[model samples]
Target: MGWLAAGEGYEIALVDGKVAARSTSGRSAGKQLKTLPKALRDHPEVERLRRFADWLDRHAASCVAQVDAWMVSALPVPSAVLGEVWADEAWQAALRDLVVVGAVGEGPDATGFLRDVSEDGELRVVNLDGETVRMSAETVTFPHPVLLPDLAELRDFAVELGVAQKVEQIYRPTWDKPSDPNQRSSATSEFAGGRYPSRFALAARAESLGYRVSGGYAVHRIRSGGRMVEARVWIGEPHREDDSVTGGLSWSSGGRHLPLDKVDAVSWSEGMRMAAALYAGRTGER
Candidate 1:
């Protein structure tokens, strides 16, 4: 994802040649706040997100434990609308039934865990229990709006838990179903600015947690079949944005695009390294 961004004209990739590193550098620090001290579990917003999470688990059962569907394109709605939205009797009723069925799970505190913190640092009240849930600035990290789920983590987890086949087949169907009416309305009507058209975003959290990487190349396409995904890329020297612009002007030369293919399921850096390896093969042979 990061490589794609670099290829398409995003100039801010880091100097380390690590795409994941560059992305984490650009995230809003607020996302780290998702972890609230246990003492604050009773906070309203925490309960709300918990409830929301439970609701998600219950209704989106197909996607609950799988990271394959990581890209959940959503609008950043103003904090004011959360209550009204959650207050929809039908939604609440569904939530209540979810709680009854143990699908929502037990809340550590009176407040649920699903929460949203306003930009002003105020807790918004959700209709789940009519309580104000607090937002933790520490746990919230605002990443690039286009990031997708880090499937590598899920793949590892599935292997560890021995659910690889079941999870892979169930959670990520061959095709995505149509958006629900409720889901469509939320995306179209109630989000910040407007709908986010970009469906995939790069995950920096996955990188910080020790996913290997190879990046800073250009990707032409991604091909997936029979449980394998391959990234097609091109190799070229890594140059700072300024170097490319000025050098191009001086020599009256445009950029050159190489033909390279990087393997998938490797860290972002490793992926780029694969591209470099291919490039080396051609040049060294010559």
Candidate 2:
């Protein structure tokens, strides 16, 4: 099949279980995807593509996580490691276009794009500024967006470099830490009373309120209390008929359950709003 374009200015295609986006126009069109119709989105083939896209995002995030750790822990990485992993296309793609700083003394933070490596494992960097610099450190860092002083300017720089991040990095909200020192979070929703004639209607109503349908759940993600949490309201278990009654919603962080009372303030309200929206759609045709 030919390329299926999703968001504006970009066409997404699956090649061997991997999703790749090619820019069709000069501008970024990430917002265009939010309008994808439910029917088209739920199509089997489309779902597969989205899964692949999500995988691509996770891969990029994994690379970033590793780099962030290397920076934070002051871990000493062998130069050979970079030379080795740099040859892997997946690793390279994840690392490409990210702002990388040397282990402090190696050099100032630079926008990484093109590079060359020595046979011995030393890496030479060519930044967005068209300047060539060498990092002599054993480790590198990919700092969080909130920690970057030149974040705004760097985003513009990324655009110039044709760095279209597959992950939600550019816009995903970040906090210095969770606002709640108690490390507690919970979510309560008024959507408990709503009933739906079908799962499609339930999902549609939630979508109207900006919740995303993931698998058998309608998911709402919120960043609060120093955590990125998700409230997943059940639409149905997989393989269930559209008429199935969904179970209660639940809150989680990093895949672990979050208590309803401990749910952060923002998460609590948004979760309730999503629940309320879905609840309103649940009707037995009465």
Q: Could you say which candidate leads in lDDT?
A: 2
The best candidate in terms of TM-score: 2
TM-score of every model versus the real structure? 0.17, 0.41
Per-candidate count of clashing residue pairs (backbone under 3 Å): 41, 11
Candidate 2 residues lying further than 4 Å off, grouped into runs, are 1-79, 109-119, 128-130, 165-286
lDDT (0 to 1) per candidate: 0.27, 0.59
Residue 169 accuracy (lDDT) in model 1: 27
Q: Per-prediction RMSD in angstroms? A: 24.1, 12.8
Candidate 1 positional error at 89, Å: 4.1
Q: Please, what are the lDDT tens digits per residue for candidate 1 over residues 96-119?
A: 211110111224222222333344
Native-vs-model 2 lDDT? 0.59
Error of 2 at 173 (Å): 6.6
